[model samples]
Target: MVMTIGLPTQQKTRNNQLYVEHLSDDIQDHVYQAILEGVYKMFQMFGGSLSEVLADPSKKGKLKDFLDWQIPRLRVQHADLLDVFQGVQFLPLDKHAFLRVQCFVNRLEGRFGEIR
Candidate 1:
């Protein structure tokens, strides 16, 4: 009934419980934790392969932007308007812009490891 997503950190924080749960002892690499129960299951249900459209060359532009810094910043910024807005400056994306990012989400399934 819930959904979880990963947003890599530019700087580490001591306060996040998700980071604590996922980090291996060495700390150089860590898995991302999904707050959602069903998200990992749904991703596995998709056959564990890139979609035909995503593998095609024409989707490169969409993939590039999704891999870039802009998209994640926008997601974080969406959470708390005044706090996110305070002294922060970044390019913005409109509501319709997210239609293209699903491919990137699909690619994340085995990336940080599944929930179970």
Candidate 2:
């Protein structure tokens, strides 16, 4: 099953448009920081940095499996922050999920210029 974390359908508008709610800059930054922290913790648990995992094919596959397993549990643990990642369409189980996840990580790396 493709598990998703999002707001209820009833909360969507009648038009059915994918309207992204605007968050204040401060709140957005806070959410970004929280996500980074969670992702970093995951990397630490895997005993490697993002760059290390990406460079090593074996580790990359392992990370994909690890993320697929962990994301749901993390969602439950961080339920209060679920809205920050609302509208995400990919579950780690999806066929192309790992590529999308890699792209997301690459974007983050670009934005921050380093994993530190």
Candidate 3:
């Protein structure tokens, strides 16, 4: 049976695991809004174009599963900065230390023509 707002969906399986379909369009939008902001975009992992995958219904499950597995893995790997909502802390370092990193970034940008 379908459930209303503020109630969990009920399942009939022995383990009582609720089987949910893909998120409704409204819920998906709200989630995207919460996670991303102006000029910032979600990172895409696979080589295929996001628009191409999203246009086909059959691709959605695989894409969703990949994201579900990858996001948490990324969060754990970058937990220090990922947990922060505001700007990250990279201040109060010695001048040379800061410049060293900056120089590396400058070299990368020179070679790659913008880091993203």
Candidate 4:
């Protein structure tokens, strides 16, 4: 005999994609892309690889400093993204910091169309 199971309705209807997936095309193309580029530039300014920085807890403060510097500039032009950032605590590092940053980058890459 074969058995079948169904997911709960709430689980079945849940959206697993990042909030960026729900944004309008223009916002995703312009605003989200700008935010991703800004973050890429900030990673450049950090003078280290993303994995290196994220893996080392000692590097957290330096990463936070870069975010502090970058956020105000982004706020001027990408306030909507900033709001999402704040809502998501995107700039802060917690115990799950590595996963958080990785997931953020992955989502951006997925939405903006990855080069690799």
Best by lDDT: 2
Q: What lDDT tens digits, residue by residue, belong to model 2 across residues 1-116?
A: 12333443323454877565543332344454555567667667765787787778788787777777766565443434553554366544665887777788989988997683
Q: In candidate 2, what residue range of length 10 has the lowest lDDT sum?
A: 1-10
Top candidate when judged by TM-score against the true structure = 2
Give model 3 RMSD, 1 decimal.
Answer: 14.9
Residue 39 alpha-carbon offset, candidate 2, angstroms: 3.1
**Candidate 2 at 109: error in angstroms?**
46
**Model 3, position 7: C-alpha lDDT score:** 23
Task: Return the candidate ranking by TM-score, descending.
Answer: 2, 4, 3, 1
Residue pairs that clash (backbone atoms under 3 angstroms), model 2: none
lDDT of 3 at 37: 32
Q: How accurate is candidate 4 locally (lDDT)?
A: 0.57
- State, as a TM-score between 0 and 1, how close model 3 is to the true structure: 0.29
Stretches of candidate 1 exceeding 4 Å from the true structure? 1-49, 70-116
Output candidate 2 Cα RMSD.
Answer: 18.6
Q: Every model's Cα RMSD, please?
A: 19.8, 18.6, 14.9, 21.3
TM-score comparison, 3 vs 4, better candidate: 4
How high is the CA lDDT of each candidate model? Answer: 0.41, 0.60, 0.50, 0.57
Over the stretch 1-116, how does candidate 3's per-residue lDDT look in tens digits? 11122223333544666564433432333333334331123425352456767688788776677667655554332223224443456668798998999899889988997584
The reply for model 2, stretches above 4 Å from the true place, is: 1-29, 76-78, 81-116
> Candidate 1 or 4, higher lDDT?
4
TM-score: model 1 vs. ground truth: 0.23
